[model samples]
Target: MNKLTLFIIALLLSPVAVAATPIEQRMADYNPDGNLTFDAKRGEALWHQQRMVDGKQRDCNTCHGKDLTQAGKHVKTGKVIEPMAYSANKERFTKLKKVKKWFKRNCKWTYGRECTTQEKGDLLKYLSQY
Candidate 1:
């Protein structure tokens, strides 16, 4: 093969070339909001916090499990949810669209509203740590 073709092949085969890290991609979502910063501490707190949902307490941990590295089950459907930690599941937040979609769906389910960009950034920062 020619040098140019070989280079292209190598680029295609390299995992790093495939996409940005979950944290990096998540950060891009936060960048447009001037002066916003993501805090893993806040994310962790959010992860465990309970909110009133239909007159009952609900939180991300209710469905995601206390351990971010471990797989969790859907509280109502019994369906398996992949681990949220970037370390445990490299696919977690790599796609911008998928991340946005889940944040929209999950935030509403857990908090009965859309998460602010700050909340999304914080949660992603927290989850990416493990």
Candidate 2:
């Protein structure tokens, strides 16, 4: 093989190329052990948990819907959200920017506060499973 071809192959096979995903990078703070230790069950529960917001109940399911594989509509804007599950959607948690953006926006909207590192980690863990 040519030098350039070999270099490209080596780069592709390097540890950096096979390193943790964007979600994993975000979860690193909560998962210091470098392992996926977050509880998916807890994440699932948190998604369904209803919180009283301004005398109204709100949750991730409020817009994302109960089924992760199906598209959901925004309660207020009526905007359609793409399916979150990797099974149903080819792209999910593939971009760090989008992931951070949505978590920040959605967490504040649902819980009235910024989510903790653990909360974000758990949520990503739960969503990635599907």
Candidate 3:
């Protein structure tokens, strides 16, 4: 094989060389303790689990909807939320800072506290599947 042909082959395989998604890379940053394990099933359960918010029961599904691929609306504000599934919305989990910002805001709003690292990892893992 000529040098140019080998370069083309390497370029074609470059995507495979890049293993982790941006979300996964962010998760790794959060897991400095090196013991965290993410579970999508747990994340799904968390997404559906309800808690009292301003005397009303709510969960992530209240705003994100049961279908991650479909758009959802805020129960009170009525603001449209883009689809949560990465497949449906390519921008869903692309940025580390934005992901953390939403997690901080949403977890407090939905569960009355920030999510633990495991929870965040699991949620990202679950959403990335779609």
Best by lDDT: 3
Candidate 2: where is the Cα deviation over 4 Å? 1-36
- Which runs of model 3 end up more than 4 angstroms from their true locations? 1-14, 32-34
TM-score of every candidate relative to the true structure: 0.78, 0.75, 0.82
RMSD for each model, in Å, please? 5.3, 4.6, 2.9
Candidate 3 global TM-score: 0.82
Best by TM-score: 3
Tell me the tens digit of each residue's lDDT in model 3 across 5-89: 9999999999888777776677777787879888889888888889985688899989988788999998889999999987788
Model 1: number of backbone collisions: 0
lDDT score at residue 111, model 2, on the 0-100 scale: 81
Evaluate all candidate structures by whole-model CA lDDT and list the values in order. 0.84, 0.80, 0.85
The TM-score of predicted model 2 comes to: 0.75
- Point out the higher-scoring one by lDDT: 2 or 3: 3
Cα deviation of 120, candidate 3, in Å: 0.3
- In Å, residue 104's CA in model 1 sits off its true spot by 0.8
